[model samples]
Target: MELTVLGDNAAQNSAGGGCSAGSCGSTDHQVSHLPDHIREKVENHPCYSEKAHHYFARMHVAVAPACNIQCHYCNRKYDCANESRPGVVSEVLTPAQAVKKTMVVAANIPQMTVLGIAGPGDPLANPEKTFETFRELSEKAPDIKLCVSTNGLALPDAVEELAKHNIDHVTITINCVDPEVGAKIYPWIFWNNRRIKGVKAAKILIEQQQKGLEMLVARGILVKVNSVLIPGVNDEHLKEVSRIVKAKGAFLHNVMPLIAEAEHGTFYGVMGQRGPSPEELSELQDACAGDMNMMRHCRQCRADAVGMLGEDRGDEFTMDKIETMEIDYEEAMVKRARVHAAIAETLAADHAKVSAPVMTVAAGTRPVQMAVATSGSGVINQHFGHAKEFLVYEASPNGVRFIGHRKTDQYCIGDDTCGEKESSLTTTIRALEGCEAVLCSKIGFEPWDLLEAAGIQPNGEHAMESIEEAVAAVYLEMAKAGKLEQAVITAAA
Candidate 1:
């Protein structure tokens, strides 16, 4: 829990004086830096563009239940409603059922602009079901952006078919380019109608992944490379993975931490393998971000995730529920067009506003961490007592970069007694241990006083303001008041 200061001269230069390289900032600023074609693809994609996540939503349908390879970190589970990781879905569906559910979701949730098929299993492994869902959706819900995630063993073979269905965004999980390191992660692969094990299997998977990446890039498909940082296994090796994928025309790199909880029942989890700490993950991302756009807002969403990132509405649209709900997709598409247009107009206006002031820290000023309570849309609009989680960001001379989120119990339950409120507030304060400030729409005086006692400042002045701007404003205010220098001294003591 040491403070990792970002936005130094090097980071600012690499990030073009905006946010950290490939991290959060104003949507207009981030998009303007990309090539015209790439910008068009990511401008409204919630997962691809950090800024757009505030206003957009993405969902995945679990139609592909057959995987070709085995990863120690992955445990595909069906009928699991409590777990929120990848490869877990409540119920598997047919292509027709997937399309019906998607239309219902889109009609009800206008913010949903992207539909991805990242499965309880690899999409390409079950070609017919995956493509059938894509083909039908492409013909029916043409307005929704189509995306798929794969392990890439079958990608080269599926590329031609993928293009026919108009899939523009693809995510390939390329953990390692070296088969030696890969052998430790993947145990086996079902290739050529046989089970290939150990290093041989790893080699084939890597070759297929690299080949598939090249082919997808050649076809003008936007590719996002996802690597899981296994603490002792591929943690140090992922730097090489990032460089290799970026050289092959990958548009973005997402270095996600391994999820190795023992209860998940994965090989790594049961064997006591550990995931990276938040600080460790952030440092690795900073290292790999020298010239690559690193995605920092990914939620590692489930195969059947719905609604905005960090919030799931899958339960509301189960197969049984879809059976009863009526959907008017034609009218829904019209409304979706209007909603997208308004979002575009708002982003244009936001882009026109003067950019947030870029400050330079004096030699000894330490970076500070701040927590923001937002209900998505990149604005600090959630009330302090009502928030179940707070998105944490680090502010320094370099810029504001989202690090991760901390979960806590909501403090203001209407029926809570005084002792219960105090306990909840205590839990919240403990959850925000490293943050120097909390930014929310509103906070009660009692919690504010307690936060100050714990050396965390409480600020509600930036309600509804962009999170990055408000973070910068708070940092500048603290610096001008000499609180930053005092903080450094206080920490040293």
Candidate 2:
């Protein structure tokens, strides 16, 4: 049978076979350049100041795109689900050839510590190709780590083979433990040369997969689980996977964001109609956190990616490279002019105006925009003296602050000042009215509407606990870039 490889999506946690062909980097692109204001805004985002906080340290190469089982949600037309999981296959390679591609990648990226085989198909289902490549790599480049992600349908049979090859890590995509929901996602399971479904097949598959995880871990292999955080399909099941796999010795839990691949010819389009929001994604991650390490930095690289941070690799990747040379002295460069364009367009607008990009609430929905308010002759209320329920999850530049209700202390506006305003619904609304954005655990609709109307951006989607801390991050970044004095809020107040 002919095999095809489709690039992986967002971060390779889901979509297709997890090759992430869609998000691959350009071989010789330039670093994305941002305007001063946009750069300041970008710096405020955690990725810039504390990137280590969200990095995943592995890479993948797509070898096979064929699957033995037909999942209700399964769309194996593409070799990888990453870029657009259900698209037509763009590239395909055998395991030996895939390894050669990976070695070329390892040379350019020293931090790419682990190598994985994810596919257009189930990695274990194509055991010979998967293990054959692993065996070859073991002999040619013994120092590099080997990893594989599978559907778990064929995992039990491939366990010994993987162990024999000294494979160190594995990522399995298990959505639900219950057969009812399982049936919706998985159409038919091949067992005994017959198609099985309902609870029987689900039970058999989950049991064997779980047992295989135990066996693999028993052999001293590290296990990582990639669970899709699909809202209704198996939202609650995530906690269970975390609980079960953690018990079975899985070390890392990568709760991936589901890609809503439009027009990728597949059953998923007919099965589901939407994708998860940033807020919803955070909710699953928060709910699923447990003893298992959660991987946040998954770039979901392509099956042939060869640079750190999913930066593009030039022509360095090939089937021959896998036989030798695990590291590349020079890294590949990426050009991000388009990404920079988006950032600049949003930032250069007057922060004070309620523009299209500005924070603004729609007629019927929640605050749909970040209305950039007007800079006024009236005194600026940077800090609302009224301290309400404040909670700080992480540390920030501004000393300790609250995420819940508290008494407001510092009123920086001109003297003859208003006493510390009581932390009330009115005060919350007033505070958000003046601030560009507010990041908190939750907010009331009353305050949300007021903030949007008054030109404040409600950063309600983030799961962070500290607002001042994030603000401080923005401050420090501007300071380091030599733009702080003019760009930052003054302490004199």
Task: Flag regions of model 2 displaced more than 4 Å.
Answer: 1-58, 78-89, 290-292, 310-472, 475-493
Q: Tell me the whole-model lDDT of each prediction, alpha carbons only.
A: 0.84, 0.49
> Judged by lDDT against the true structure, how good is candidate 1?
0.84
- State TM-scores per candidate: 0.90, 0.56
Error of 2 at 393 (Å): 10
Q: In candidate 1, which residue pairs get closer than 3 Å at backbone N, Cα or C atoms, i.e. clash?
A: 7-398, 54-377
The model with the greatest lDDT is: 1
lDDT of 1 by residue, 174-201 (tens): 9999999999999999999999999999
TM-score of the candidate numbered 1? 0.90
- Candidate 2 per-residue lDDT, tens place, 198-261, comes to 7788877787778787777777665667777666777777788776776666655677665544
What C-alpha RMSD separates each model from the true structure? 5.5, 18.6
Winning model by TM-score: 1
Instruction: Point out where model 1 deviates above 4 Å.
Output: 1-28, 77-79, 360-364, 407-431, 445-450, 486-493
